[model samples]
Target: MPHPPKELYTIADASERWGVTTDIIEDYLRSGKLQASVHLPRKMMHKYTRQPTECSFSDEVDVFDVDSCDPYSYMPQQGVFNLCYEDVNWDEAGKATLEKGGLYLSRPDDEEKCYYGFDEDFVLSRDKVYVSISELTRFEGEYGTTPRTEQQDCPEKVVKVSQDANPELHPKEKESLLKIVIAIAIGFYEFDPAKKKSPIANKITNLVYDLGLSIDVDTVRKWLKEAAEIVPRKKHKITPELLSDFGIPPHAKDD
Candidate 1:
């Protein structure tokens, strides 16, 4: 089915764009770290089918009873559910709506496919409640990526420092940091790009924040190569691993 042209994204798109794993995204949803919305059935909106007039289904539901408590919106899709492992909208209009404190809902496309635009006018009523993780999202807060102009009284404080201006790291310090980066990047075990997407670059970026140092992923990778210059060399490392998740090549060969 065709989707609406509204400002909405799916879980996969959200993960790739936000630089976060779907697992982390799901965790945020489960914990309510991310605000989300679910899709309502069209049957609820129609008064004719409000009653359990059907005799086929084992479990018959009074449409009015369901609508009384949680009146899901039937805008996006008819009977199809609206959900995502992780999703978000960073468009200007989306931000504007959020700034004014309005939430957007993805409407069902004319073609019947998911991934359409958000409905700004439709707001959940006082009694509408989400029962499950219909769709995990980073629609608000940190993951929401609110712009500085729209930030709170005290906006996020951070001093930008370019790693290019910094002096080269000593071998030991570089190696230690590299080890930490690799450990975190590989999620322990061994470093392989083929099996999974290595977040090495992102990990290094995070470490720089933690250590208050100016370090780039290239610098860290260079340090790794420098550290690898040993008598017997370290041990097994990369071999046709899939670092493509990080936008690298599959079976990434040694540089």
Candidate 2:
């Protein structure tokens, strides 16, 4: 006879069954993606014992009962995986409503306030939400890329120098530079240009090449420097991996 499936699966079992890594399973449990019920023991006193000098005493206390409690019951219902808005305006409204300490309602303009309540069977759908064009434009203006109106005019002198500078340099270097120039014109220099000449640069250049663009190191560097000047600096401190890509040794001290 075939063996029956077990009632409870451990963390490893869940990971294998879901085709996800063990770390992912742990993350799901932590984020409450998967529901789990835990059985705790409830203590009970069996009987009473009597001693001549001490009078009555407790006898047996080994009895226990299974207490079922859902560990993920306390997870927030408004998490990213649980809730979604139809459009940017609705999303903004939802956020505003949440901030104002009100229940989320699908109809924002209805005369009769209708609210959607959370339930045990509630699950978030992965569909993309629709938003107003004006709201989308506003969102893009605030958080997305602005229109690139500036045209990159590579100086004839610089182009000539790049062409004549070094024949021995890798062909990938040239392609990398061109991409840097384009990125500079559009303003995207969050990384050091020298680092782009390294393996990481090679990878990015390859991606750009696949998109049908040629690149090189010098070209990439120039544009990267320009972009860096135009873009705001990030608040996070740079890591050693980032520094090392720019031909700088891992242990090198920063000036």
* Candidate-wise lDDT, in order: 0.41, 0.38
Query: Total clashing residue pairs per candidate?
Result: 15, 13
Candidate 2 structure lDDT: 0.38
**Per-residue error at 193 for model 1, in Å?**
54
Q: Per-candidate TM vs. native?
A: 0.23, 0.18
lDDT of 1 by residue, 67-110 (tens): 23334433224433333323332343332222111222333333
What TM-score should be assigned to candidate 1?
A: 0.23
Q: Pick the candidate with the highest lDDT.
A: 1
Off by over 4 Å in 1: 1-6, 38-255
lDDT of 2 at 53: 41
Best by the TM-score measure? 1
Off by over 4 Å in 2: 44-255
TM-score of 2: 0.18
C-alpha positional error of residue 37 in candidate 1 after TM-score superposition, expressed in Å: 3.9
